[model samples]
Target: MRRNHLIALATLGSAALLLGAWGFQYLGYAPCKMCLWQRWPHGAAVLFGVAAMAAPVAILTLAGALAAATTGAIGVYHTGVERGWWEGPSSCSSGDITGMSTDDLFNQIMAAPLVRCDEVAWQLLGLSMASWNALISFALVAIWLAAYRKSAP
Candidate 1:
């Protein structure tokens, strides 16, 4: 595909991501801390996409690729945490409160988010949303990288 098409796709991806977040919120699915972490790179990708369209340079495309890859990597890590392959942060992950005082427990519970990073709140075709996000963002990274390579002089 052409460079312009790649840029357009990246822009569309950002819009899609934003829409999905909104949909989830509307559906009463509040994002956990880690879920919120995944939004930064998407924002960067969208900005890079605009830059790619305006300048169409290798550096901008590379930035876009990096942004997408960063988010994809985060998604992969989050997927691992969800699958219990590795541990997530205690703040987002569940822990024992057997010894804590009532006040402490209450404070912890109140501060804790509704969504747990280790829990698979939603899934599709046996894959969690993070896995799907990783796959899609990785593809977007490839597209951005390809656009950069094609633009090389």
Candidate 2:
């Protein structure tokens, strides 16, 4: 396939994933902070793909790859959080309240976000959406790499 087609495919892949996420959101799955963070790079990659098509620059493809990597990395982190491999950000993750006053505990409860980043909202074949995003975004990274190699002189 041509470099432009490869770039477009990679870009569209991100777009499709974003749309799917939105679809899930519309279905009443509110995205947590981490989930929202994972979407940003995909958005950037879609734009980078358009820029690559217009300029056909190897650097743009490289940037797209970086964008993909960023999202992929975040997905991995999110998956780890979901699996309890590690704690997520305090703003979204449930923290211990072992030594809080009644008022403090109440305040924490009131301030807590509706969506907890450490919990899996949905999963398929034993994998959460974040895991799937990581896998697919990594594939996009390879596509971006191929585009870069093809366009490079």
lDDT against the true structure, per candidate, is 0.85, 0.96
Who wins the lDDT comparison? 2
State how far residue 126 of model 1 sits from its true place (Å): 0.8
Model 2, span 102-142: residue lDDT tens: 99989988999999999999999999999999999999999
Local accuracy of candidate 1 as per-residue lDDT tens digits, 1-153: 898897788767865875786688689888877777888889889998898899868899889989889988999999999999998887998766778999999999898877899998889999987888888889988888888887878
Regions more than 4 Å wrong, model 2: none
Q: TM-score for all predictions?
A: 0.89, 0.97
Query: In order, how many clashes per candidate?
Result: 0, 0
Question: Native-vs-model 1 lDDT?
Answer: 0.85
- Residue 125 lDDT (model 2): 99
lDDT of model 1 at residue 135?
88
Where does model 1 exceed 4 Å of error?
Answer: 96-107
Error of 2 at 8 (Å): 0.9
